[model samples]
Target: MADNTSRIVYEMTISHAEFFRTLPAVMGALPYVVDGSEVSALQDTRRLKINLSPEGRRNFGPIPLPVTHVELGFDGYSHEETQAFL
Candidate 1:
């Protein structure tokens, strides 16, 4: 029998702190990203621009200051699995 699964590369932008916090939760909730796809890949790149002003500092604080971008690739995910994941 031949496999009928498809691959997808999902990308999203979020806060640095939010990403770290959600990472584990997403993993626990769904193992697709964590379990590893046929050629699963992940990339995290922190925003280069940083606000040094007092207001910026006060609003975002220290830990959650920068913006983070994530890219994930999932291979061999079935239609039902993808639907459930979404």
Candidate 2:
């Protein structure tokens, strides 16, 4: 077990609900499992705080090259659960 804590800052233009769903997939692709407790989502501001681990670092292996910015398209997933919580 390595006590390695890393911080990754990503600029994702996604809604709050969409981010909740997509985050799992994105984090899953990383080498480490995200510590949800340390995850902070500020959708209103389009900001996300993710506390990563060694496995995450190993999996993601640093940020992408050139660091191109892109927009994410959200489907019905955003509204599907809206009414449930309301």
Candidate 3:
């Protein structure tokens, strides 16, 4: 078995005001978890950069990665990197 100690925590936030006024899409975004903190919005970016060492060789697949890894000043996941990540 592989060790599970390394963790990645992402966090992003927007004022309630931001989602209030500029909301033609927000009306249809409720069904999804995109309030206060979330991912997969309306944008475009194909990237999957994972660098692991021999000691950290493990599978991160079943794990639900966070969207806060995107940092800030970006939109959302308009596209996903459907590459062979194994």
Candidate 4:
């Protein structure tokens, strides 16, 4: 693992409701530290929520409709090793 901390930033478009619904599955695919947080929102909508977990665990309900896009941000160490893993 590299000493430097890095962040993974990406964008996705999804409905407000759908975003909340799939939050858990999305977060599960990410490599967060033991304790981490996730901040989410809808495009152009004022609705937003921030969830924090000391164990880096996230739980989101099922989304009925499709999510348009989503913006994902992750921060952690092992910056150099990440590329090889990907």
Candidate 5:
């Protein structure tokens, strides 16, 4: 398995309105993990560069992989469940 422990994490936030509007688009961007603590409704101005080792490339695909639009899929969650959680 590829080693993913060396990845750089950048935490950011946006308005609740903007987040909702962009959530679908964001979900299609890349391979990432979402943590409860990482959710917020305020803007955070911070950025970081990611340096991927060979193993990271194998795990995450190419460094500049193009993302095609994908329909959002919410598995096993009702509308109310998703709204309440968000």
Candidate 6:
């Protein structure tokens, strides 16, 4: 257990039907600032952002990771729509 190679696994199971049932409400409450073409709780490849870590430097060496904020198509649906979905 003390070895650095030790790994931890997490497993959570939710039925597909249940997953979709709550997706709309969940999406409506989370806030993201990206201007994506479409905004939905659904997993769309075009809407996701790619964040890379600042690793592997040849000169000054590595520094602390900077704070990051992810932008999205927009903040969830809206207060009214979110309430209805919930």
Best by TM-score: 1
lDDT of each: 0.36, 0.36, 0.29, 0.39, 0.31, 0.31
State the TM-score for model 2.
Answer: 0.28
- Candidate 1 lDDT tens digits, 1-86: 12334444333435445554566555553333322212132223211111111112223544544433343333444456545555
Better of 3 and 4 by TM-score: 4
Find the number of clashing residue pairs for candidate 5. 0
Q: After best superposition, candidate 3 residue 33: deviation in angstroms?
A: 5.4
Per-prediction TM-score, please?
A: 0.39, 0.28, 0.18, 0.33, 0.23, 0.24
- Candidate 3 on 1-86: residue-level lDDT in tens? 12212223233233334433444453353332244433333323322222212121223587543222222222221222221111
lDDT score, candidate 5: 0.31
Q: Judge candidate 4 against the unseen true structure and give its global Cα lDDT, from 0 to 1.
A: 0.39
Report RMSD (Å) for each prediction in the order shown.
11.3, 16.0, 16.8, 13.0, 15.2, 18.1
Model 2 clashing-pair count = 4
Off-target runs (Cα >4 Å) in candidate 4 are: 29-71, 80-86
Model 4, 8-77: lDDT tens digits are 4333334455545666665464433322245643323222334432222123456343323332332333
Return the clash pairs for model 4, or none.
12-69, 12-70, 13-68, 13-69, 13-70, 14-68, 14-69
Error of 4 at 55 (Å): 29
**lDDT tens readout by residue for model 5, 1-86:** 22111222322233334444565564453333433323222112222122211221112344432222222223344455334433
Q: In model 6, which runs have C-alpha deviations exceeding 4 angstroms?
A: 1-11, 29-46, 49-86
Clashing residue pairs in candidate 6 (N, C-alpha, C atoms within 3 angstroms): 33-72, 34-71, 34-72
Please give, for residues 1-69, the per-residue lDDT of candidate 6 as tens digits.
111111112222333344335545655644433222222333322222222222222323464322222
Off by over 4 Å in 1: 1-13, 29-68
The TM-score of predicted model 1 comes to: 0.39
